[model samples]
Target: MNELERSVLAKIDQEQLARLCRQLIQAPSENPGGNEESTVLLLQSLLQDLGSTVHLQYAAPGRPNLIAHLGGGNAGGGLLFLGHSDVVPAGSGWDADPFTARREGNRLIGRGATDMKGGLSAVIAAMASVNQHAPHIPLTLICTVDEEANALGIEHYISTAEAAQYLACIVAEPTDLITIIGCRAAANLQVQISGASAHAGRPSDGASAIEAAAELVALIGENKQKLAAAPHPVLGPATWNVGTLKAGHGTSIVPDEAWLGIDRRLLPGEDPQQVLDALLAAARNRIEAAENLDALKLQIRGSVQMFMPGFLTDPEAPLVRQVCTTLQDLGAAGKHGIWTASCEGGFIAEHHNVPTVVLGPGEINTQAHQPNESVSVSDLHTAACAYALIALRQYETSQN
Candidate 1:
């Protein structure tokens, strides 16, 4: 690595790093109405102070995306570090206030602590360090809103002309410090069942949509193993899940409508449409055969809509090799492979055609999205150092 790169790695400030992570958790950009205005502004102010040019764009009225840039001397293609500012709502079950960004000993506890304001903070801290040393790599930091709800902000950014130039990208999601070369695609789907409603006394004259929904769910459950068996060279198997179900308003009346929400994990070659068709076919068969069915019909509703597709990068790809070398330089073991879960890897690789990977602190088994969510302070410092080293490697490769 060059002198500038070495300097950048050495300048990381641990206190400021932890502060950024905590502040983001405290901001409460929860998915229900995901407000990232304050969070974006915080990053914008910091980036501007570090002599980087920044821009804020919106997907919806209030939500914003912050992009900060630092140019290299000879830029063929720059590297982009992307992550989201929004987090899922912390519903009732917490021992500590989920939005308070509480710190107990070495762990930082909050809604976004591990899923991942911690990842975002690590990258930002690395950026601050790189800025002080005058970076040799052309770097861009993209912080967008709505990742927890939908990816509207990132989808909007990807559709733009100016965002297409990057050669590679990284999404700083929690990964137990492993290098994620690929991720399965998380495709959101909805199934609706409709039937005629009647009073409890006259149940024979009416159809129960709730019953049809139950039958449909049964059909899906039976086929779960089949769906899970689809093979991918890298991603291994696709997974299916029914996340939510709702039917009926009261006990006296038969439900006329029922809704079911599903999360399908796509392997590299699996088509979302095919998955939907298979589900629809199963529902149609089950609905037509069920007892007490006056009339049964199933239809697919709106989906996640922004699926870019699953992706994998060759271990020998230039960017991958560069990152590996950098990690080795930083005293890491330097292994790489595909992760079973989904992340923005699909977006960066499929939408932008950029070589993308997810590498960060924290362990994959550490109960993210569960109560007592937290990240290790030791991992935090280590991840910052790793990101700094990776940034330097990209610059070194570009020069050669």
Candidate 2:
């Protein structure tokens, strides 16, 4: 590495990165509680210490988004590093306290350690290093809220002037250092089936909503098989899962109401509205064709609870090429690929038409939302170097 490159990499303090990651993980920003105020404040303070301009924007009460900008002489617009402050709830089943960040060998363990606290901390460290060494590198750091849930923070950001002015964006999602240039869309479906209630002994007196729900589940499974046959080349296939199902309260009574929650993942070029409409139509058709006829007094309804469209950035896009080149320079895999999971990168790419890439430390499978979540410290250092290099490269390119 050249002297300047070595200097940038050297400035990435490993201890500071670990400390910051631990602090972030210790702060609870769980989505269900909608509590990100403390995390937001922590980030704000960190950015302020670096002499960056910080602003707070709220999508809801106690849920605030932080935007920090480091001015530079580059004329090619700004580069945005997008990350979320909010994390999924730390469910039961853990060997240690989920809120306490612990260092076990090379891994730092905590609730948000890998999901993105590590990535976020690395980016912040890189930003600080870049600002000190190369002040001309224009950078924007967007620490958002609600990414684990509805992505309200990102939704609120795209409408701002800062998002519109950015040339490209890098989403600091855990990718195990593999660069992600595209992602599949995601949506949640809620289906409710209602039927007359009756005692279990009177089998002929009332219809069972539980049975109707099973029928709908079977129908969805059949449709899922059909969808699996036609897979997207990059994203694979559209998939659905019955994440939740609820029925009657007691065993002695026939279920009068049932609820099913389905999580559907879609590929690029698929219309979410059309997909929902098709699902509803299919369910209605199946219910109408049932052999029981009108005597059952059954009703079915389905609605979409959430929808996030898929997006793909061209491999040749400036941002993608830059990241791939940086990864290669760092002796890492520079190949561009698609992320099966949904992230805010797609939303930014789709809404702002900005070239975006999801690149960061940690593996999605082993770390995100799982018990004893952690990220490799070595990976964090590598990501810090990559982020600094990318920012410097963008700055140099802008000068030309």
Candidate 3:
């Protein structure tokens, strides 16, 4: 490590880092209502204190995003650190208060602590550390809202011209300190089945929409098996989930309407539209082939409510290499991997063509979206160092 890198690493204050993580977790920026204004203001103040220029942009009335820039004067390209501020709802089964930010030994426990608040705090601390050394490398930090819900904050940011100028992006998602080069795409599918309604006593007079919906659901399950046959080398197979099913109002009446909600995960090369079309066609064919259902006059409609394309960044890319090398220099094993869950990295990579990687602290399987979410304090410290070192190295490379 060079003098600047050493200085930046030394500037990381563990207490301050812990305090920031606690404060953010306590803010309760849950996505259902998307109350991120408080979190945005907190980040704005933190960035300002680090001597960085902070901009607050709103995608909606109560939903805001924070963009902080430092040291862009002499650099031709800058590194962007992207993180989300919103967290999934903290459900029951917590041993302690989900928002209390309890610390036991090396672990800090709370909602959003591992999912991303801890990562976000690490990024903020790293930015502050790098700012102290007065390095010439340009850096941008983006803390977006609604990542747990619709990801509107990032969706809005990437639509602007500023998002296209980044040399690379590091999304601080929970990755257990490994480098994630790709992630699967995701889409929400809604299937509506329509049929005639009648009294429960007259079975032959009315068609049961519930029965037709069940048949369609069975067809979807069969299609899922076909999708699993072809899997991406890194991302694994495309998957489908029937998340929700609703039909019929009462036990006495034959239901006229039914709905099925599905979550479809697409592989890197698969087209989302094609997948939807194929599923619809399968349902249509199955319904037409059914001998008894012809008299029921059943109809099925499929629509995609949301779509996020999958992406893969070459492991040999300059930014990816720098990140891996920096992690190794920081005394951590650097390995390239893929994330099964969806993240903003996919959107950034597909829409802006920016090479993006997911690298941060905490284990996603054990900590993310769980009742008592927590992150290792040691992991947080290492993440701070890694982020700082990567920024410094990227700056040096740009200068050469």
Candidate 1: pairs in clash: 176-362, 176-363
The per-prediction CA RMSD against the true structure, in angstroms, equals: 2.5, 2.0, 1.9
What TM-scores do the predictions have?
Answer: 0.91, 0.94, 0.95
lDDT of 1 by residue, 282-359 (tens): 677666766656543333333454454567888788877776666677677777877876776676677667888888
lDDT of 2: 0.84
The CA lDDT at 237 in model 1 is: 70
**lDDT (10s digit) by residue, model 3, range 95-161:** 9889888899888999989989899999999877887786566788888888887668877877763
Taking all chains together, the TM-score of candidate 2 against the true structure is: 0.94
Give the per-residue Cα lDDT of candidate 1 at 107: 86
Off by over 4 Å in 3: 73-77, 161-163, 294-296
Off by over 4 Å in 1: 1-5, 73-77, 296-308
Ranking by lDDT: 2, 3, 1
